[model samples]
Target chain A: MSHDHDHDDHHHHHDNHFSPMEARVRALETILTQKGLIDPKAIDAIVETYETKIGPRNGARVVAKAWAEPDFADWLKHDATAAIASLGYTGRQGEHMRAVFNDAETHNLVVCTLCSCYPWSVLGLPPVWYKAPAYRSRAVIDPRGVLAEFGVTLPEGRKIRVWDSTAELRYLVVPERPAGTDGLDQEALADLVTRDAMIGTGLALEPEAEA
Target chain B: MSRCETLADSPGLPVSAEGEPVFAEPWQAQAFAMTVRLHEQGVFTWAQWAEVLSREVHRPGRAVDGADYFDCWVTALSSLLSERGVASEAEQSALSDRWARAAEATPHGMPILLDNAG
Candidate 1:
């Protein structure tokens, strides 16, 4: 099949300007497409999937469900991959999973010191800070300080644990269930769970805050 | 807030505003999708991708602030493709040169097509 014009619309409207990297990526894509090794449509679909369909909302639902159901929480704690998959949130970057629960005395934070190995199927693409070198190195060197940068400050006595994610394993920080959220249902609770909450950079919104 | 503002607000740690685009640039997302798509198509295993990507990221003299993250991604992808015999480095470089020429030839507001090289 002729590869010409296959990715015509994929080009950004940049007044015919292309950065060196952009040109390189385009060239690589063109070569790959011409060789029939990859389909431009497949690339578009993948990008679209991550951009719209897959995101933190899925993780929020998982966290909300865990907070609502004790059994589910147990499952998430034990076997996160299966537990998260059962919720229909399973894909690349999240093949192996571990759910680190945040409690009154212990708070869990996640960072990939090597690279950004975030739980994409659940928490969506990692936030910029999650991939920033400063955050990656500092999250391990000074966990509390990193949290403070995100405006999160745990009580002095509370223990902070930083989980380093790798390609083989990814962690999801299930932020502590906010108070007065008992009356709220899973859907409402999910709303309280922000993207950063699951990444341990922020907390779940309190019932009052959400209201 | 705009990306510029976000960068300025947190120079060291650029925190994206709520509802900000997942990728800072379209090309970044495109590079990311291409890698994932290639893996899904069985061109390379996830482990292989991770190995190459990790090596690229950890290479000495690389930007410590992660600004060259996607550059690493492109380099890793090219090496992987070369290793897998999908595309040789020479072939990729030649095609990249063609793309550079095509991009220069294409008029403003028009898509840069490979055919433009000719």
Candidate 2:
């Protein structure tokens, strides 16, 4: 398969050669940089921000706070944008926000049916599957099936609500806190929250699972 | 099932060992960063970027698995650059051709300098 071949080549060569797409990207960057349209440093900074600094860890902290504090939970439900921004997480693709809390009878899943509109400030970039047409189309139609593929099987009586993110607004799913974690602090709680959990594709790790 | 197996089952959805989504190639990330950086620079609004991206993503005969996502992104960015008069299509293509030649001339394991094209 092409994917396998590419993977093998990547392992052996280690950036010795550029693929057609890679070359195109490089060319575009060089041209834009020369024209003063974009700074190479700024490009590196943006990529570095997404790759190393911003990620689900930010969302996990938010989720942890909500689990430990009821007032924050209420604020998140009412005005997610301000609540999230208050925590110093506010920027593009996250200007408008809504925190969908999974409860005993209801589960929330976020998807961008039109395109990959994700809460970047809080949760970082969307996952590969999150942007795939299969997930985008089937998420709203057959959420349970998609969840099952991700190894989550909700109770038959539970209702699944899929939120379709748009350019104007985005969603952050507050997964249900795993049981028997009353003693844990916010920082400890954050460790249990995974990226998929916030997207409602998986559950937060059990307290024991973390150990 | 293993993560690799799961990913193989679901085409085009690769993940890192930590289970986080990763860019398959550095170019994809570069293309993505360019769009965001340009938007931040007011070259285009996020709404405009979204509109063009959505159109490119939904275009007929595109890959459904999103393997061509960055390709569409580059195309959408190019279209916006032309529409917004930031750069003409001809200018961008000429530069692209020059970069291609530069890359061809550059020695292995060295940077592909634009100066090499001349």
Candidate 3:
């Protein structure tokens, strides 16, 4: 798309308070408007689509598919992009994914220390901590340490793996789906895949259901 | 972290690599810092990054907006790893092929582009 609008980049200079990307977003929006490539109606549609339908819905599908088929689950773990596409629900970051499965033997978490490199196609935008430097620098070195701070305790003698998502390829931590989901169909299982579960911050759906 | 430091505290002001004080503009410094950070994290080597960056530079009418900034960044990272033997040629080719297939099916034209470039 061509950005042809006469944007006031000077507006950002008055306070010098906008992040470069933030500034660029604003400038691009103006340009899009001028070029008639986008309008207020399109912006609303875009935001509404992302906020209501895309991110969370794709996440649920991934969780459900994993719970239903073991072979599919293995494929997801090794090659998340193709695995997700197999279900016809691949999103943006899921285009290049490496799904890390968390279990009693190992736990996986994600962080974008440098920037918020999240797989928005499946999980949407990142939460605050994913972009925080504290989480990023610390997650790689001491995953167990970070999990403890998050109030999650790893089983004794279990190893913790932290995957750092990048601008090109991103990761998703597939927390073990709760056991009670055994008979649930793909639709029902998808409900269990919360945003937190996809981010590796929270476990799969189940508070009281025991393993 | 320094980039985050600059983002949170100073917003528009850029910080030096040593975390020293300076007044580099946000986009310029962030673009520069992200390049540096990727290097520090072993995402890619400087030489390989420079090669892909030159391609964007040769393309006309790209400097005005930030559209190409992150796009170039990610492409450089992908290329750098392939060039340096960090990612095997097979792995690189597989990833590229997968990305192409996914892009075709993408209703919105490659969601990854929106994630990184948006």
What is the C-alpha local distance difference test score of each model? 0.75, 0.73, 0.54
**What are the DockQ scores of the candidates, in order?**
0.17, 0.13, 0.02
Candidate 1 stretches with Cα past 4 Å from truth are A1-55, A113-116, B1-118
Best by lDDT: 1
Error of 3 at B45 (Å): 50
* Descending-DockQ candidate ranking: 1, 2, 3
Q: Considering only N, C-alpha and C atoms within 3 Å, which residue pairs clash in candidate 2?
A: none
| lDDT accuracy of residue B44 in candidate 1 | 79
* Error in Å for residue A40 of model 2: 22
Q: Candidate 1 has which clashing residue pairs, if any?
A: none
Candidate 3 residue pairs in backbone clash: A92-A121
Q: Pick by DockQ: which candidate is best?
A: 1
Q: B17-49 in candidate 3: lDDT tens per residue?
A: 544433112223233444444454555545556
Return the TM-score for each candidate structure: 0.53, 0.53, 0.48
Higher-lDDT candidate of 1 and 3:
1
- Candidate 1 local lDDT, B5-100, one digit each (tens): 322322133234553335544466778778766776788766677778778888999898887877888888899999999889999888888877
Question: What does chain B score (TM) in every candidate?
Answer: 0.79, 0.79, 0.38
TM-score of chain B of 3: 0.38
Q: In terms of docking quality, how is candidate 3 classified?
A: incorrect
